[model samples]
Target: MANKRGNVWIAVSGVVENENGDWLVVKKKYGGLKGKWSFPAGFVNEGETLDEAIVREIHEETGIEAEVQGVIGIRSGVIQSTISDNMIIFKLKANSSKIIVQEDELFEAAFFPPNFLKDDEDASLLLQSFAEEMFEKMLYKIDGLNPGDQFGYTSYRLFL
Candidate 1:
């Protein structure tokens, strides 16, 4: 199947925490965000759910298997009034600490201390703000409800 919607792109990013309370971040090797540190993220593929996309992206970028805890945030905006970019941010729990960064997509990958990005020069402002806000308050999350089939769409997940 082809992508019928060309103007809209959906992406997912995960904020994964290790057992030591360190957060996972990746440095992009290309694009405008080159050299900037942020959470592991990628565009969703056709037929992939947001949760599946985030988990896949996290593993693909950082080689860390993570379980989605819930959705933490969402960012949506229009680019040049032509393209719509929407990103879903998920909170994840890392299964292990060891990271094997993907050489093609990332410059580096590592776990950082809490609030590490707050004052970091190489971090994006949005990421910095997220770091601060995440630690400062309890975030409301949309969690998965049981029996996805109840919605009639087998792949549909109810988050509440």
Candidate 2:
């Protein structure tokens, strides 16, 4: 169900990095990535702007109020033979640290430090591979705006 761009669907995600550089990832309760970790993301609803969709998805999946900073990166490719996958990655500044998991879609959400997928040890090869595939390389950088410059995100983890 793509929009006017001929894409199959639009997947919007928010990339929020903490002061310690750890990334916010969620453990899926179902789907292919069930029990695995990934960024807080979801499909863009009909008649919703990218900005609105990203913020809504983040809050719906993980209880984080984040302000859209700017575009981080985007990846578009083919999936399942003909299905078009258009993924837009946006950097968000979390205004709060409270993490109230959405029980229906996700079971747990946490911040994983960068390089959690290191290949040095004999940890789980599959997990490492998944992490690499999910977030192997970042194609963008940021300047001027720090992690929590505008928002008052004191910590990445906040108990509800």
Candidate 3:
């Protein structure tokens, strides 16, 4: 495990699903990445594995119990602020339906098609850029109809 700058933070996100096949994205209310559109995610607690963090974060943030299907991918990026220096991004595919927001941590919760990030107005520019970049990579992979050389990007693992 790589440590960022000096601070260590591990975060897990769940790509939860509904019966209609739409994915869920939550509007973060506070924190460095606040106001951005993202899947349900949070820090990894003591004695927890990656999957455990995924299940815990999903339940805590979205009020949904998710049975994780598999790993999406892991992303690590630098935090440009003084508060934190790094972020470990875990994307997980989860089986879920009901979503109950924990009020203080999120602003709004909604489900949309996997491509919804393309048209979201409230998503931060950084997030939109990341999402778009990942989406394009995924589209190309799908066009090729192969997962080979396609699992390296952020969107490929998260959007499926």
- Provide the overall lDDT of each model, using Cα atoms, as 2-decimal numbers: 0.83, 0.67, 0.62
Candidate 3 yields a Cα-based lDDT of 0.62
> Model 2 reaches what TM-score against the true structure?
0.67
Query: Regarding lDDT, does 1 or 2 come out ahead?
Result: 1
Please provide, for model 3 over 92-127, each residue's C-alpha lDDT reduced to its tens digit, 9 standing for 90 to 100: 444666778889899877777755776788765544
Q: For candidate 3, which ten residues in a row score worst on lDDT?
A: 135-144
RMSD of each: 3.4, 10.0, 8.7
- Residues 1-160 of candidate 1: C-alpha lDDT, one tens digit per residue: 2245688989898889999888899999997789998889889988878889999999989889998887778889987878888998888899977899999999999999757687899997667978888643224444455555556654655444
Best by TM-score: 1
Angstrom error of the Cα, residue 67, model 2: value is 1.0
Q: Judged by lDDT relative to the true structure, which candidate is superior, 2 or 3?
A: 2
Clashes by residue pair, model 2 = none
